[model samples]
Target: MVIGAPASGQGKTTVATGLMAALSRAPYGLDVAAFKVGPDYIDPGYHALATGRPGRNLDPWMQGEERIVPLLLHGALHTTAQQPNPARIAIIEGVMGLFDGKAETEGFASTAHVVELTESPVILTVDISHASRTIAATVGGVAAFEEGVKVEGIILNKAGSPRHADEVKRALRRLGIPVLGVLPRDEAIHVPSRHLGLVPAAERDESRQALDALAQRIADNVDLARVVKIAMTAPRLSARPWDPAAEVHPPVAETTTRPRIAIAGGRAFTFRYAETTELMEAAGCEPVEFDPLRDPALPPDTAGIYLGGGFPEVHAEELSANASMIASIREAIDAGTPTVGECAGLLYLCREVDGHPMVGAVDATAAMGPTLVLGYRDADGTRGHEFHRTTTTPAEPTMAPNVHASYLHVHWAGAPELAQEFCDATHAYASSRPDLKHHGDTEVGEGLVDLAVNVRLPGPPAWMTEAIMATLPGLGAYPDATAARAAIAAFHGVTPEMVLPTSGGAEAFTLIARAIPGDRPVVVHPQFTEPEAALLAAGRTPHRHVLAPPFTLDVDALPPTDLLMIGNPTNPTSVLHDGEALRDLAGPGRIVVIDEAFMDAVPGEHESQIHAEMDHLLVVRSLTKTWGLAGLRAGYVVGDPRLIARLAAQQPPWSVSSPALAAMVACTTDRARVEAQLAVVRTTRDRDHLIESLTTLGWDVVTPAAGPFVLADSHDPGTRARLRVRGFAVRRGDTFPGLGPHWIRIAVREPSVTDALVEAARV
Candidate 1:
């Protein structure tokens, strides 16, 4: 989610960082990925402090139009915390005004641009210190100003009193956006700043304590859970994972040692894209960190050097004092080692900085310029940013042998070819289940109508088919699920840690059964049988909790069990259980696992437990029934992070094929979800029609049926054979635990097809 403001001084960073700190630390206990939506690196420092994750940037101009969503998902899925875990939500602090971007580009790299690309919901933070109800008009205008930028809510910063907040809220009531929070004037909530921007949080001795106070202030005012829910409402983003290896060119290694790329990182140089190092590592380079102010020499065997952007100008005297470090750098460059410098690095490579001696590799003196040179720069198909106030006598960067020093800051994610080329130069740095089931796939024989199974689609959608076909060329590459997991997490409003994408839902059952501890496991019968079958295969005796006719789950009737499995809108019974009841079945030592493969068949999925948060509850989802990709076997389990991790450990590597992962990436987007919703509505209409027709024929169709298929008592043991003789194949009910042969499961199709099937049955 993007936490933006109408303009600067509106507390965008304060609220964003505070929220990240609060959510990650307290009552919420959520792991948050923090981001800044532009090229500036100042605010991200505080955000990193708040979240304990490397705060990243989502710059469209620098990274390119294609990489916006991929970068966001990658950062959200991977955390650098001490105890690394998937970020539950990502909070992006907007740069400058919400819509402000490049002056000539009409907001090209704005927060709104990132929000649009990632489909992230925004909570506008407006400064109410000098305004009141007009803040409402400003926010409403911002919301109306763009399409695809969803402003979910607003936070009123520096509000005067309860009355002022109430006035703004009242005015915003018509805008239909809630006032998520109101942070009153707090003098203690400010961070000290320098010329470039806010001082690096690492440089502040009391940064942690200050951030704690800020977090407490925000937590006291903001509705953290409500914010999380709004974040969850952000639509799933669709994109293939940006694989670093795929982006980097194939490496040619001559030496046994992996080339060490000495990356400048200390109080002086803190601005660097995380992906830049990632791409280098992916290309077989060992990224070594060095400090110019303190380090006596570079890392041992440093084959390359990357001097990134920072405040070298502020530390010029100290950098000059470190004569040995400067000589170390000069010797490496003179020795023809590949070295790249950007912004501050370029300034340091010059002969002098404010009369202080420097590396002197590029025979030019450098000093603070009168004006800042900054913006998006595209040269020879390369995209980068110029963000420094320093100037050199040579003006242009020197591209001498084995060295390319410039002020241009480039994110390797956008120009991966550069990362590839650079890493190849530094080449040498070493290195970077199951199933059960009474099957659901039903193929109509010759000309027969297929009412036998509950697969909603007869064929994959055109986009999904293309996605599967796209994976065909990359089948040789071992499936890397970074993109698939992130996409799936966004789709279901859960952290990637809580999701384990399997070959199919069946594999999930096998994994959970094998990994999840439950000596007293129980499977609710008359639902899908995969859970029970998997348990039996894993050598566990599960108590069968069979519901009587009419099939509403009665938890009271079941004995106490550590593991319980059921289905939403259960198969062969078509009875949808309340999510509240299912959640009630999960507790401290108990796991409530629900198979929701058919939940997509329900309009709105009102009773699905997929989005509910319970440590012991798990939801098994499948794309097979929804997208007709049973052969591809794309499915996942969203549940307790610990349980999901266990299940993931048990899953065989690459068990879910590339095509299946691609299908998962394709099926979770907002576009696919919109299409899925329309299908659900159509299915509901046809299902109602089918029930009416079957009722008229005295087949006794079940009421309140919620899945794509409806179960009915045909009142004849010969009904399955009779339907087959009439050119229709309906599911035989005897195979299900509680149902007899007289009952049949009928998949809902088009209304006309339902009518034809009913007419054939009458014959």
Candidate 2:
């Protein structure tokens, strides 16, 4: 749930962290997961201290909307994994004001946008120390100004007296929004601030007491039950929970073997994304975490080292005192072990940090000074380093190959290749069991009818092609998603913040594999193999729920799992499950992904989950098939904005080319949508004719095929070969988890192609 305020300095952090602390106490006993919206790393520090779980940032602009819910779920579920109890609630503290975002006019990354995406009710905190009745008008304006944002409750901060609180509550009752609590003006409740927001909770002595007192004040004055109820009222999210493993994308060759990369951790290296280790693992490298502040040496057989951002400045003396640890790191770096350091990590590698001796991996000294170098940087010509935000003094370059130490804290998610490059430079090799990355495309060679692939032949219409070509001249500029996102949002009737355009539907699966964090991920089989393949690629083995003959989904018969994947009008079998039944599979802690790649092929798009707004539901749609733009590889994912953000965080910058973004925008337009609907009708008709002819020829065809393809039981191994000899190609179903060599998948075609297939069957 989102905790926002009318404006800055309205006590949002105080209310949010206090609420988290209060909810986590005895009576509630809710394992609370806290998040801070936007790029600031400081607020999450306070959130972690208050909730006893790591605080995460949800930046819509930096990370993307597809990742938010997945990140939220990852943090929430991860907290459960570490603790004795599971997290029962999630609290997201807003940045700036309720409606303020990346810009003053647009609410793209605002608290309200987050609220709309998660479908979480909002509790607006208003500083009511001066005003009484004006609080109602202020909240009412915020609630009514936005279409989807729901202001369920309010909290009046710094109320003058009991009478003042009553006056505000009475005024708010007129608007029908509940007043959850009131904070009287108290000097003891305020957290101290410094140069960069509040001094991190770790740096302060009175942090715990201050948080406890703040929580106590909230408990004494607020309606705790009402707050919990409001949070619980947030609908079950259907997007897959974010998994650190899914966020990592190691090159295929590296999957089998892994190199041990020792990453510095502990209180000094506290600022790190969990995805960093996951990314290393994805690149076929094992990330062994070591604490420079405590561990005497790096992990055994360490081939590389990584030092992330933290407070080396604060613990300079202790770190300097650990001469053995510093010496070991220095030796490893000097020995040409691939090493990368960021911010405090860079500081630790210097000759000295704040006049204290360090590892001396780099030639320069890093002394803490009054100057601060901070902001998002696109490091131009700084070999190997990509994009990041850093707050540290500059240092001289090191002599060793593959040794990079900088103040910039780069997020590997936005630049996965950088991680792979680092691993390749180190030549770190690790092995794993062999797995096939096979798909239908591998079966269709040159000089064939090309029935093996599902995409429509002849590709997208001319008008769509022209639209894509129009974007070619603009390729010099980075692909701007604003227009495409706006178009998709208009098509789906959601805010622009709700749509995330990906490279392809396959990329969507890969993103899901890398971002959505979950244990016991279940994939419904005989549908699409990509989901499982992507998961396996990310070092996750999904449990396959192989359906019988008709390939019907029995939601009740399924085992309990946190992340579930199902295809709409499933591939190969072509069975569309009931939409309500699909929705029923989702609950408080489950994410249900409906792969609607083939949904547009179904007439009227029946049972499509795209337009729904459930916190736990994610709908993945592909324009590649319907628009016949497979070669271009375009698609979009719809879900809670938070989930979109998490998935998007795993993607590299400009992952989707300019032309593809234009195609996405064009295909979602009114005229293009109409053309697509007509194409679906034609495809359905062609599919029916093909199914009938195959059945008449005594082939055991799968009935009621709703996709653009039909599955036939041709038990003989020679069937595909025989068809190929007759100048036709069909997909071998055996490669798919549940089906065997006997089953073949044939794409729909005109009567001319259907007649060719019939003649080939006779051969």
Local distance difference test, each candidate: 0.83, 0.78
Per-residue lDDT over 685-721 for candidate 1, one digit per residue giving the tens place of the 0 to 100 score: 9888889989988888888999888999999989888
lDDT (Cα, tens digit) per residue for candidate 2, span 258-318: 6679888777776676556666765667788888888766675567888987778778999
Clashes of each: 5, 44
What clash count does candidate 1 reach?
5
Which whole-number lDDT from 0 to 100 does residue 398 have in model 2?
Answer: 36
Q: Candidate 2: misplaced stretches above 4 Å?
A: 78-81, 84-86, 103-105, 130-134, 170-174, 204-210, 249-260, 281-289, 363-400, 413-763
Q: Best candidate, TM-score-wise?
A: 1
Q: List residue ranges in candidate 1 displaced over 4 A.
A: 79-83, 253-256, 395-399, 428-763
Residues forming the 10-long window of minimal summed lDDT in candidate 2: 381-390
